[model samples]
Target chain A: MKSVPNRILLLLSLLGFASALTIVFYPLFKKPIHTSVASSMRLKIPRIGIDAAVESVGTSPDGAMDVPQNLDDVAWFNLGPRPGAVGSAVIDGHSGWSHGIPAVFDNLYTIQKGDTILVQDQNGITTTFVVRDVKTYDPKANASAVFTSSDGKTHLNLITCTGPWSAIQKTHVSRLVVFSDMEK
Target chain B: MVIVTMVMTMLASFASPLIASAATTPSLGSAATYGILSSTYTNTTAGTTINGDVGFTTGPALLPGGTHNNYGSGSPYATAGSDQANALSNINNQACTFTFAPGAIDLATDTTHGTIGVYTPGVYCTSGPGAASIGTAGIILSGIGTYIFKIDGALTSVANSAVTLQGASACDVFWAPTQATTLGADSTFVGTNIDASGITLESNVGWKGQALAFGGTVTTVVDDTITVPSCTSQTPIPGGSGTAGTISGGCLWTGPNPCSSYGPQPQKIQIAPVAIAAVPVPVATLPNTGLPPDTKNNTSSVIIISSLSALLLITYIVRGRKIS
Candidate 1:
């Protein structure tokens, strides 16, 4: 009877050890979720632990897509279709350090394909989006595809500055874009 | 009184046909091949497709997707620029058959053609310091002749507005604006717009003629399609198959020559010059979304996950030791 109780404890400890190992390496084998959202007021990337506010923005004086003034927030291009609309809706965020604080998209480059992005609106309804592609572009590259979509499906694209910094230009040399599609 | 009424009706009918005379068509010359001709052409989105040639003199013309003969300050480009200047001058010098004073002018409703907005071949002028606008109701070009619109100020069209052609050719339509010309989003415009101040096209604007901006930039946003009208003898007159008569110059038409009848000229309205509001030009660059480099790394999640894993492992080891 004593041996039987000891065996049960041994099996339980072994099971616990296996569970801990799996938990540690779970991200490596995890499959990505494919989904998308509508009429966004907030952007949530559960994988990177980002839950940031979204602000509406237009073209800047220099005719570029404007970014949010706040480091913690993302700016949605209001001139284009709204998030979850038929066309491609663009949102831009700041990356790098802002006054010793991490900006909203500091870890944007770490986002992987198939990640789930959630957009929540004022009505408390949440829309989900799945990552389709991640691309890098030159600073002077024609980024029309980021703002326009002809497939007649709702799309959301997130943009952030990546690559090497240009001290003279006061901006990044390249841009990182995350293209997502609204879940059907 | 009955005789007087019959005579008045006869006079009105006769006067209607003589309201507008055919305006002279200015030759585009080498500029005819270009859908977009400017000193600098700037396009933001990759969706813009120019069906004809695109020429620029001073350019970093960032056009990514389009099937066209792209020219930069050489050969036909320089010739096209000169031809555009000449065409602009010719159109500007043409006498106005009807002029509308600036404030609150809609081409569809405010013109002499009244609510019908059907304009015959003539030179129409909007004497401004004020702007002229085409509302959503739009306007129709009715006959086969040169139709020139001379706006001393800015010209803008509302979204979804269409410049419809009835029995006219798109090639014969010219818009000469002294200031900037803005075609609103998704608006379908049919004309050869010659502007000294610049041309800005909003998203999805479908233009069937040329955007010739002399000494100015031509800026296009997302998904604008500009096709240079190929004016050939076989150009079909939409509703002019049966009753349509051929003019002496081989131009086919459906209606009577408006200038053939005798009538008094229409009164022209002159408005005081108002100062035009300057439109902001779009610069060709992407947004600046990067911050300065930081030494601090954002690895809070990684730290947390690793710590949790270590704790789980420690717990399992301690429990196993106790069990043993």
Candidate 2:
């Protein structure tokens, strides 16, 4: 009788283990196809009071994304996928507070977690996204993270220069990137 | 004692470099100044049209001056050879030692499969044979930044599998293949430096970037066009990010080169601005900063704690059996 009860207990434990493994690896088992989407035109963030026009900026002849000449506009990398697309859409702006001039992303560093960002496309379709990550890299940091797209989810990464402003380099000492994910 | 050993093992795991997935991209240094640079061998066939200057250092006899009349003779040849030597030294010393950013995608993840479609700027590396290849539709590289394809094994492109760029300058792409690299027939490619052991370009391939065989040799056929990017107006600061440093050379467009008549720049679109709501000051205090949580370290910690719990449970089971 005791052996029978022990056998039943062992069977129950094996079933529990199998169920736990299935729960943990469900995402890997269920492969989902993620399709790439189109370009975005407008960006809205209610939490930080950020509503601005986006300019389609191409790569500078020097290989970096061309910065928006106007401080009021944000430069969107036109070559990459649009915001809410299958890949990561990168947008950059000046965080200039130098020479007494305030730039578009001046308060970008103050963004909080869970903040909502809304992106609108040319076709009048809007996608809602939430702040998922924020990171800072030194001026010499490998910026490849700003461009990688393996997760298959739409990501909008906003970039602005932070840290000490170097007059010699004519840019900041570091770059601040805020990562947001599309609301599923 | 077992508990202590297990704890120490877990601690050492956290301290191991292999546990970290991030690696930084290496800087190219002075090597970025050249179009085609070879250390040991540089030669071209009769029909080969080289738009850029070619150079070689350690040669069995002499590096072959290209069929191009203007660039192959006299002063151009000497200058190109010397430049190639300097660039090769810089590459072997600087670029080879440069740290790589954490490579996210394993180009040979499937080993048998090849990657296609548009990709953003980043470092893609592979460690095995049949690592990375371009398909018939070809692969497009988007963005205007530094992109590195570090292949520890061989790199080959299928026929008609073009490697195109979107808004990026060809000079920004760097292909560092540890083994031989072959461009298939009729494949169009853009990029600056290719630090490889041996590079072979098949017939009828239009290449906008330079091929630098830093280790072995470069073979190019007459029907193939390898135009070194005359980055006259565009400054190519390879490796690092942000502002580019100033570089000096004869960069003015006095005449047309291979890619000069490409086209006008793409137009920029202006979108109307939307109204933004006023930002509110936070009233509550939070311990954690506004950045993403440190999930990597936290996951390790969770694993360690779970293992300890499991060990304790096993110990309890043993004690119970002994009592019974």
Candidate 3:
């Protein structure tokens, strides 16, 4: 009788334990789709950011900003893909600043060929673009191609402060502008 | 209290994976945002066209050097208020041409709804196999101050002739297998593993920007890995975040190139699964309903039986010894 009871108890306990364990570990099995969605939300790669407050406008006939004679306190946009009322979209940023990481334009100083840029509208629609060339010129006799859109194509212009940093007033001697066309 | 706080901290740390999922979803939206150049001055005024011509963004882009060429308004290549002059306009009807024939160019910023053109150190209305086959060139006579020129149309600019910039820099339309939706001097692009064929770069040719492909976005998939950004696997990054983003090769800037970081930009992650330790998941606890708490008798019974079994075995062994 004792053997019988012991045998029954052992069998019952083993079944009960297995059930208990399965219930506890059920979460280990998950939906792959759900996992993928979760993974995407995570930042797998790092990216860059510019100012979100600059006004949006298209290219203008004479929409280019006047280069300050005193390069000392230049005021302009620090992001590309400017959205003005008309003309090619313009976005400007600072190449470097006296303090801090400066602004979005700080990275403009390192641009090279074959780069792509994306500009978005207030509604979150991105306008893709690519790099063609770099230009460095004296502010005195600045050219028009830097700001103008030849072939009347829609493009994005990114401008920033360039040249050696000034110690006294603290500003770049020359301003840099990058012109890019809208990517298809 | 300290123990309780520590426990709580651990629990929260364990649950953070569930908390970081509140960001926005990346999706490739529609592809239909093109701006108008002008009602007139169109090369082939047939269907919509996008011209990617200008390769350089420099001060004094260009000037009209010949007869009736008061294009820069006067001051040569770049003069007072001539910053909008372009290198090439709708010339030769080369659809999608971003170049000019080295001459006087007009910056129609003031001529609202008119054809506007600009210049640069490279070929104006510069054409090539890939660039010329698409988008039409135009000089719309639009009202000035840059009214149109949006980047939504099917337009692009590739290098036909090489352009040189500052002594330390070279310029070319190094067409990567991938193209960007936008371009800029502040941005530079580097093609990884993806062989950039048929595209040549000028000596010391340097640029900064995100690498973009004209064909929407490209992505490849293998047995266990999905590479690049294919139409099915990758979605378009949302727009207007205004965050200076790195599109791997994404940029749209002009001279004195606005972008600063040119060394080695971010690299593409050959996405593959990695083995990781599995952790237990949190579960909901059931409420304990008040009831008569009965002590479990099985354990106690087991203990007693075990003791009895041992005693019986010892007795048997002693009996056997005595018999022998």
Candidate 4:
């Protein structure tokens, strides 16, 4: 009778040991997989009280970078590197919304250097970037540097139309660009 | 005794396969220094600026206009040429995670896109002898992973077509075309072109990568700008370290080669499966922490089970001794 109880205990302990080992090594045997669903990403600027969805935007028919259809959301330049990638990852939002409704980057100009921006990817990994510089450019500025980075460091540049509204151009006369680097 | 033996066997089996694996990036070696490395370099335009080293075995050594280190047919040039060949070979050997159908393959159309095709990092290839072209609509390469486009035939881009990078670096993007590569006029291109044949840059082309031709000439027309991409760190090649043998020279761009020692290596981003068709929805609820809840639970459960097992084993041993 005593041996029977001991046998059950031994069996239970052996089962527990086997399961613990299985759990410890399971991830190693499993293949790591990822799917690129750009919509799964989110952008948050705590300083500006901005937490908005990020939509992948491509080039328009006129060969210019496209923007999000909804003013509340921002458009990620899908044609360039991702937000946390090695090159400059660009995200553009609208400063002015119709009916004076709140927009994603309405207060983008208020963002000062050293501000923190968080980008959450599909896997829920949040990449933090620190604001480095803030610059304003003419509507017709070359703006090539806004999309490309040569220093090989990861960068995130936020763009929103700023300055006085341009009635002739049907857009803002100046553009605001917030340059940020990936926090080490 | 039998149960203990069985548990020990299970533990050994599980622990024996606990080998760790890491992803690795392809080393460019000395060739990483050049914006244009070719057998023969020809320039028809007067105001072309190459932002990196320019090397050729045979050609006019003088560039029409640019502050660049020109390497003539010498040791450095020869080393770069050999390095280019090795890089091309390493690229060719990579297994294609995604393969386009045979025929004239248009990358802009074959890959999924919202307005333009946005490609994640992976080995994208064309089967058989099919030419690949980026249409006038252009294509976007988004993500940090290594992108290797292996074209079995010629590669061409339409005029004004732009290869945009979202968060992808030009340094991590590689293009290996078996035949000649021609960039349309005024088009913006990115990534290193290791073409088996020659590479031709039309007028007013802006290239943010290298043009490395194996044996053919690399020609640039009027007002072409070629800049070598500088990568401080790169996403490792998926699966394992690439077959590309390690070469010595580090990042060579003009400014401090921040990538000289290949800075902090980021986690390898795996290629997404190609079957996803629907447009990515804006924002889904994401986990609040870096680790998902399920993973945390699993980890906790493992720890608990391990503790319990150890305790039970000790108790069993003690009880057995007491009974005896």
Best by DockQ: 1
Task: Give candidate 2's iRMS in Å, 1 decimal.
Answer: 20.9
The runs of at least 3 residues in candidate 3 whose Cα sits more than 4 Å from the true structure, single-residue gaps closed, are A1-51, A56-87, A167-170, B1-324
On the 0 to 100 scale, the lDDT of residue A9 in model 3 is 49
Q: lDDT per prediction?
A: 0.71, 0.54, 0.28, 0.68
Across B61-174, the per-residue lDDT of candidate 4 in tens digits comes to 223344344333323456667887777777777677778778778787764323348887677888778899998888898866567898889999989999999887787788
Q: Which ten residues in a row have the lowest lDDT in candidate 4 chain A?
A: A31-40
Give me the candidate number with maximum TM-score: 1
lDDT of 2: 0.54
Q: Sorted by lDDT, highest first, which candidate order results?
A: 1, 4, 2, 3
**Candidate 3 C-alpha lDDT tens digits along B1-324:** 999999999998776433322111111121101111111111111111111111112111111011111111111111211211111111111132233223222222222222333222121232221222111231221111111121112222222211122221111121222222222122222211111111222222222211222112221111111112112212222221211112232222222111111221223333222332211111111111111112111344445555555555555555556759
* Cα lDDT of model 2 by residue, A36-73, tens digit: 11222567788887776666554555556666555566
| lDDT per residue as tens, model 4, A1-184 | 2454777778888999899888767655654222112245689999779988776555555555666656667777654566876667788876654322446677788899999999986457899999999998775566667876666588998887776655455665677888999999
TM-score of 2: 0.34
**For model 1, how does the per-residue alpha-carbon lDDT over B1-324 read when each residue is reduced to its tens digit?**
999999999998886545534476676766877888887788644577788777664442233244454334333566678988998888877788888775546787774544467888888887645577888998898876778888878899999999999988887889987789999999999979998699999999999999998578998998899988875422222222211122222223223222222223323233332332211112224578888774333245445555655555566566668969
Say which prediction, candidate 1 or candidate 4, comes out ahead on lDDT: 1
Q: Is candidate 2 or candidate 3 better by TM-score?
A: 2
True contacts kept of each: 0.31, 0.00, 0.00, 0.15
lDDT of 2 at A183: 89
